[model samples]
Target: MPNQKKTKIVATLGPATSDKETLKAMILAGVDVFRINFSHANYDDVRERVEMIRALSEELGLYTAILADLQGPKLRVGVMSGEVVVSPGDTITFRTGKPFEGNAEEVYMNYESFPQDVKPGERVLLDDGKLIFEIESTDKKEKVVAKVVQGGPLKSKKGVNLPNTNISLPALTEKDVKDAIFACSLKVDWMALSFVRHSEDLMDLQKLIEEHAEHKIPIIAKIEKPEAVENIDKIVAYCDGLMVARGDLGVEVPAQEVPLIQKRLVIRAKKARIPVIIATQMMETMITSLTPTRAEVNDVANSVMDGADAVMLSGETSVGNYPVQVIEKMTSILKSVEGSELIKVPHDPPQIRTVRYITKSVCYHAALMANEIGAKAISTLTNSGYTAFQISAWRPSAHILVFTSNKAILSQLNLLWGVKAFYYDRFVSTDETIEDVNAIACKKGFLDVGDMLISLAAMPIKDKGMVNTLRVTEIESCPV
Candidate 1:
């Protein structure tokens, strides 16, 4: 692999790029993480993909992670008779407590509590805000009456969204639970819970993972609902990661608000020291077109300039006509913004009274030291992968070379910004380990003969504790 761009790229795998040749090209094009959306495929299909990704990544000697995005209680329209053309000012009634296929006049909702939860005069959006209706009244019984404000052709099983309704469904649906457990069995590096509304939503998923997963698998709470934005701090503290699911979020909130919301979320995630991914419709134009519109390019550039740890592609790579080309274009944009030195993430100096204050401070100062000295690399020996995130949070320009004995941790670290994880099991004296890693990093082209390096490790390396040691030295300034 060549010198990696600091900002990571994540691409989804789907029918367009299912073959070995396409998958290998995507990995080579710099897809640090491959997301498997559980909504599309069954467990067997998922299992086959997991096997293929691991096999190819190992063969290519590139570190990669897998994120299993669970499809949570997605509210959708139920069986409506063949497509109906709905016009503006048309009246529609959504019926509940009845098992009947609906037609042009009435439709059924998959959510049982839709009638109970929705209030009169609230707006209802269908199919990603294409069709909008203003609720006139809800009987709080079997039906709700609505008038179409913006109308289009209605398709069966289209998604439903009530931006104002207080939905009663748990963050994780029954299918989500089953999918999560299966993903745990496969030992995916990350799990994303969709439509997170509160901190407790993450807690529920966390508890479930703790019970079933053999090892720690970090959870990324999908920030789509307006309630999730309100509880950002709590959500950041409790979850392992955050993803701005902008497709649904942009529809739920006023469209004008999503840009600032996205920027705020990035700043908060940077402060929290957990990876943040900006996802959804990043390169939607590239889904069918040969090239992206300039607006789409600017969107990717802005995300990178906002200090987003990663930018994710959905339809462009999943079901689109051009999958590998999308990844290549996304990589081009990420590298352009990152090379321009425009990203300035707000640095939160480590605080006192924190349990891991010392470790945090070491990672913080390491970034400062690297910047002041113009170090080529910041190398750390980590057992639990804590120091990598801590160092990445400070937005250091140096290449983050993480040396870990755990191969699983190596792949998992692929999601962090500026990270390039390597494997090393030899934990002798601190100096010996430092020399070994410096040599490896040099061989890997992350360092030059006279380049400065910042090394961090825990004292008494055999214990493999949190990072507590930092050293700066020139790598091979003179022939040994």
Candidate 2:
């Protein structure tokens, strides 16, 4: 049996563990949430899975979160002929023509949209960069004349990679729009956007979500591109969370830099107090084998030590032969790290000398005070869920109960660490807000009668940005 840890574990859902029995087993094995990948599953499948997960959560009396990951614009090369193998010296032409033309001198790309955006000297990589091509020239409105810079065997409909070139592609394609609407309708806890290059990308998606779903869904920016890494601070400020998507990232950037980038991303997100999920290939070998490699175990443990709010399983849970075992293994690894002496290493204290955002600064102060006092729980009354994130950054031992009147805000907090959100009817006054929090604390077993608890809240309970009060109150023996 593994030791139980407070940090959350997110397991991706796939054929191996899509049924109710497997999902329940994973949950019992310590899966804190389930990820539904929209890149593979259709709307109907997602709907069914969501309903099943919801039913199981209720039956087990657990508050497991379901995250819907949107497959953003997937840029892929057009279809090719049967099979063309090119050597390093071989010059292959990528033009628009018949696929069956056995000349083999020129290979045609079936994508009609490729010629409109590609330019001369631009590099195009296919099959995860196994086949590399450099655009030599372009014909007017018809074909792209290219030669294979680095050639290998090319297959049909392989994925394309355009690094650093901003093609005129909509971040949210028609399919993405449809998927977002469906996910929002299903009320998924978190929406992870892929291939986010800039902060405006997140803003545009947010606008689309509002137009289609009529609600503010938390957007998690996937950092898989160099451009995204350059503007990561701004992007993190805008989005609700960040995901270190190392698969495409490794393809786009130098593979050796990935580990450093992962460390940087986790630290940056922690400093910003936004939840960061370490995703992609954390346990790749586990997809086939029941047991994980020693290196994989160390990888997961390192991420936990870095203060990641969650570690995501991609194919390991989605299409793996041992999905449940992989999740269980990850949970065990997290527990081992959590109970080890490494957890006691004092985290670098947050810098408050030059605080710019008052709300963020206040939340940090409140969390520091709570941690210093060794409080059993951190109670926050919030409308936007920022306070909870602030406390989560400290990685305190105390459970965080975020009381919010907005269901949207509550759903967003599902990805955060140690946050147990509860919806409350709009409080008429500040006193009512405190009372409501206390009431919830009692019901949730976080507090007992006559226990001293700390409460932090913004005054008036109506305004959005004022957290200026902290109180220490003794719980009344009887209901007042």
Candidate 3:
């Protein structure tokens, strides 16, 4: 149990790593979070994985978080009679409903508003941008006539991308509501809403969660669309966390811009004290090959050096031949880069609101003081996990040990960078809780004799959403 690496790993569970033994191996290898993709799994599949994750975490005595990813309102072509081969310069008709006879000349799309929302000259990408179409005309009926700029064999249910159109689809589909209800019932730690366009899109999901759940499950906005990038400020302010989902994002935006966007998103989340996950194909080659390309290794390392809270593995772990190997390699890369000069460089704290200013200042100062004093850990007693998140954002050299009585909050912290969260029994006094954590740290070997522990907490311990105190103390006693 100890995660010596600063950056966390989020492993998607599928046929490759779903069994109890494989899950335990993945945890031991280095998976901090388990992601259940609703786009791929049914209710039964999700519930089974959720149960297994909980049971395995308890058996292994670890705090592992689970994220439920909503597919959102994805547009795709309906079932084709067979494969349709289209060459460049071919004219095709895209209709909203089922086609009477599916052929190469005509195709059906599932989204009802696709025809009206899309205008002439806008580009339509299919099968992950493998084929491109330029809309030439829109008829009185809900049909679009398009010229294929890049053509290939089109299969049934392949993805459709409207790169140039302002998508009018709602962020939440009927399927998303059902998935959210199911996720809440399982007490999932976080839910990712895909294809978020603006802050309003996030508000819609937030309202749905509030109306359906007793627990407050945090939402992580999947920033993939260009509209989301344009409105990132408002979206970041509204959501609890963000995911740099570069798969569709790379397709939507220019591929060359993804690196800069990833860096920008990480910095924005850091300034806001929200966790950001760099996801999609981090170790993709490992899906088949025993090892990843050297370039892929650097990609994972670069994300860690960019201060990403977590790096995700999609198909690499979901259905790959080397699930555990991918985790091991990713963990190794993170460890190597974490100790490099790039990661040690300090960043200037961004200008923020007054309350956040104070917390960030305290966190920055605590990290400096801990490094100067050779502290073993920066410990925080957090009620809402906000204080711990800020401390992690500061990227302290010392390990972060968060003591919380709230199990849900503790689970959420599992995804935070450089955070090691543990639940403590309820105490009558703040001093009692601090003392208990101090002793627990020694017992758990997170601290050794004479090692310094920088502690942060808020005044009036009963109050939530405040981080106003900092103390540095030396570990003097043995484990209690």
Candidate 4:
């Protein structure tokens, strides 16, 4: 509706976008979602930023969604003395739950069960697989001895990835529980659980939210662990959304396998009718350089062609010098791909045996009819946002214009592909409500005189039941 690309862009909020002016510019540049990563954020700063984003969204008259990304059981090394170097054939010792000056030979780790969980021959990768170590032995008390297989300069508090060992840590840690509660208090539109091992992890998080929050927020499962990749089908069906967290996933498995894994996850999510995002290092080279590497540009383009709902940027937006420029460039790439036949995503037919088959069929046909007649938009009245997600999954040529009275859902649909949500109440007569939304659409410039609009809504509109009505209207002109 805003002349934007169908594939949304999600930018991580940080020092680069802390200023109000920069954030507004990003919104204008088509950043549909702002992600607040709780992994290394200061709570006070996060609260302040959330306040600013909501205030600015009202001021700018643009709908924006906020995603609270919970840091789940992220293991790391303790503070080092300063920095040390190691080479192949070097030996290092990591002791758990003890204060010690970190050095080349010995360092402290935060995870208390590291020594108990690690075993001989398991590989340990640090600093995003920059340094690799093979476990030699562990005392099973407090010490783990490893030999450097691939080494580099090690520093304090570097991320540790145990690719070969199954560390026994709950998907939601104590910190994550507190963070989820805080995020609910902020009324963020979406919550993403990092390092989600399986679908049960989402149930664990939902239980926590149901206990503390007034409403249940939609969640996105971060598929970063090998276990999550293996359990992707269940995870896709259970969670509201999915994110292919390639950074940690590539470290967990071979880097060469991540591309295929990302494609597979996207397909599963699409079939389940859930939004899936492609994240991590999408435009890493643009962090400092004004332009992205050829490979980086190609990566974002491929994600769009693969039918991802959104593409996310991490350090490139949070700590990069060219945050706004990076978004502009990403948008340019998206538009280029979206204009081509390559962006045609697969369509999933409804299962007649499913209980909701009729609703799904209505949504599917709405999209199909809209495309057949070259309609300008597919308008739908949805309270639960179910039809919006359903129609969006079809990847229709026409934009999915969603009219809803649910205030929380207005922002939630922003992450959906090809969906533009509007806050609409006053469900009067079916004809009157349809006219009301059509007028709003024309005023917003998505439709003009003589444009064909395919609209769907439930009959007896006040009942607010499942979508059961479909109509095609020709927009002549709205009264002054």
Among residues 3 or more apart in sequence or in different chains, the pairs in candidate 2 whose N, CA or C atoms overlap within 3 Å are: none
Go through the candidates in order and give each one's C-alpha lDDT: 0.89, 0.77, 0.86, 0.90
Off by over 4 Å in 4: 478-480
| TM-score of each predicted structure versus truth | 0.97, 0.85, 0.95, 0.98
In terms of TM-score, how similar is model 3 to the real structure? 0.95
Clashing pairs in 3: none
lDDT of 1 by residue, 192-276 (tens): 9999998888898999999999888999999999999999999998998899999999899998999999999998888788999
Cα lDDT for residue 234, model 1? Answer: 90
TM-score order of candidates, top first: 4, 1, 3, 2
RMSD of each: 1.6, 4.0, 1.9, 1.3
Checking candidate 4 for backbone clashes, the offending pairs are none
Model 2 lDDT tens row, 1-480: 122366787888877776898888888877777888887886677788889888887787566788878888786545555676876655656665455442246655654556777788888887877877888777746677777788777776667777746666666777888888888888877888988888888888898778876566778899988988999989997898899998888888878999999989988888777889998888999889988889989989988887789998988888898877887888889877864546532356555664435666666666666667766667888877767887788777657778877766664676787777777766678787788778877776777776666787777667755566777677785253
Candidate 1: residue 78 lDDT (0-100): 78
Candidate 4, residues 1-480, lDDT tens digits: the string is 466599999999988878888888888888999999998688888898888888888997767999999999988887777769999999999898766779999978888999899999999999999999999999998999999999889988889999888889998999999999999998889999999987888999999888877766999999998989888888876799999999999999999999999999998888888999999999998889997989998999999888999999999889999989999999999998875775666766797657677889999998888878999899999999999999988998887999999887888899999999998998999999999999998888888889899999999999999888889999899544
Residues 293-370 of candidate 3 have per-residue lDDT tens digits of 999998998998888999999999999999998999999999888867666434566465675778777888887788
Candidate 3 positional error at 372, Å: 2.6
- In terms of lDDT, the poorest run of 10 residues in model 4 is 339-348
- Ranked by lDDT, top first: 4, 1, 3, 2
TM-score computed on alpha carbons, candidate 2: 0.85
